[model samples]
Target: MPKAELGSTYWNNRYISGKTGWDLGEASPAIVAYFASQRNKDAKILIPGCGNAHEAEALIQLGFTNITLIDISEELVSTLQSRFAKNDSIHVELGDFFEFSGTFDVVIEQTFFCAIDPALRSKYVHKMHQLLNKGGKIVGLMFNREFPDGPPFGGTQKEYKTLFSGKFNTKMDECKRSISARLGSELWVQFDKI
Candidate 1:
């Protein structure tokens, strides 16, 4: 149940207008730190709603060989496709994340979840479950505070616990020490599929 203002077109418009406040310009520091110690260099990774795909770029540099990035907006996809054109290890697609099917060892979430309609949070949880291989995890950040008006919709830890509990074994959910500008305002999460 997506809210009217948070539909694909709404997001598309955000991209079209260059109004993406969530774009971090660089890969998230927290994700970079997590991957720094990662032993698996060939794991299949998915980054749904990947805006500029800074994370995918970082993963490529880390020697990752399989990375898939998906987004519903063709506008953003075109730009990213061009950006990642020379990278054989990264695949970019324009499609709805919920309908995209694939198996991955790691699915990274950035500002995506909070940008969608709150009613669809369960769908997001279930979709992540469906896309991941057993023991695979979703690692990244989620907003810890609610917004006044949003495609940047927000929620608390309690809501996330109920949203993800049955489908995933929550491994970590706490404030991250390395978040940028929005310090102390984000939840660093790592939910492994059960």
Candidate 2:
């Protein structure tokens, strides 16, 4: 099969056509479960490429006050602005993740990394390093299996290690037992800024 086009236009069209298969419709179980056990309510959290931002809502319910969400799609961001209008705790922005600037204590990655062009993997890692404060962490799932075609590009543990090593320390990069269907072939990763 030929690879599908996957640029800003492609992703924007996906949002316009409501073809967002990546949206879980709720906070991811792995993410919710992980943060549920934490007691910090003041952590500076960021969720780039935060489509629909279900996790942001969940975080607000958990009493986390400082949350920021960024996405490149104007349509999605517009919808999100309205959806979160009454909620003052979240800061939503429409922008490229690479050019987004901020310091965060925790960055949540869901489907963001896989959605980017595979050639930008190094830039993604570097940007993550730059966006995080020292000792800050990024925790989320990553595709552990290779897709025959992608945007939703898949990767192996070795590939992730090579991509993040030297720049960050791996706290966890193991299979997530509670992932949704079709995502059984994924790994949960937690990278701490070195």
Candidate 3:
């Protein structure tokens, strides 16, 4: 159950108004480090809620050929399509994350977790389990603190661990490579689908 109607209209308005304070403007340093260590540059990677698709840009720069970027905002997706128009290695889609389907070797969880309604946390975990290959992992950062109100919702390591328990061999800890502004407040998560 959703507390508010946090749908495409809500997100579109956010983008249309430039209220995206959560857009790190670039890929998270922690995610970049994870990508740097991956030997499979051609591995299928998906970034849901891919505002600005910074990680895709970083992935392309690292020679990764298969990357997918999905977001619910038509306004943002239009911008993304233009940004990567010349790059066939990147494919961008405007749609809902839960209903969007694909198999991915690595699903970069950049802000997607905290951005959804808290009630959907379990659903998100289930969807991740379904989308991943057997050894697939969801990597990147999650805010390990609470917010007064959110779409940009926040929570602690314990809650996340419990939510992802059973389905994923989870690793949630404070992110050392997070940008200075989010440092100490974000958890560097690496959950391998079980």
Per-residue lDDT tens digits for candidate 1, residues 1-194, read 34776657877898999998888889998888788779898999999999889999898888889999999888889998898899889999999887999999999988999877778889999899999998899998888889978768878888888889988877555666545577878888989898
The regions of model 2 sitting more than 4 angstroms off are: 1-5
- Residue pairs clashing, model 1: none
Report the lDDT tens digits of candidate 2 across residue range 1-96: 222465566778999999988888888888888888878888899999999899998888888988999998888999999988888789999998
Q: Stretches of candidate 3 above 4 Å error?
A: 1-4
Q: How close is candidate 2 to the true structure, as a TM-score?
A: 0.93
What are the per-residue Cα lDDT tens digits for candidate 3 across 135-173?
A: 999988888998877777888999988899899999988
Considering every candidate listed, which one attains the maximal TM-score? Answer: 3
Candidate 3 local lDDT, residue 2:
70
Lowest-scoring 10 consecutive residues by lDDT in candidate 2?
1-10
Estimate the TM-score of every prediction: 0.94, 0.93, 0.96
Among the numbered candidates, top lDDT falls to: 3
Q: What's model 1's lDDT at 133?
A: 96
lDDT of 3 at 112: 82
The global Cα lDDT (0 to 1) of model 1 is 0.86
Q: What is the lDDT of residue 184 in candidate 3?
A: 93
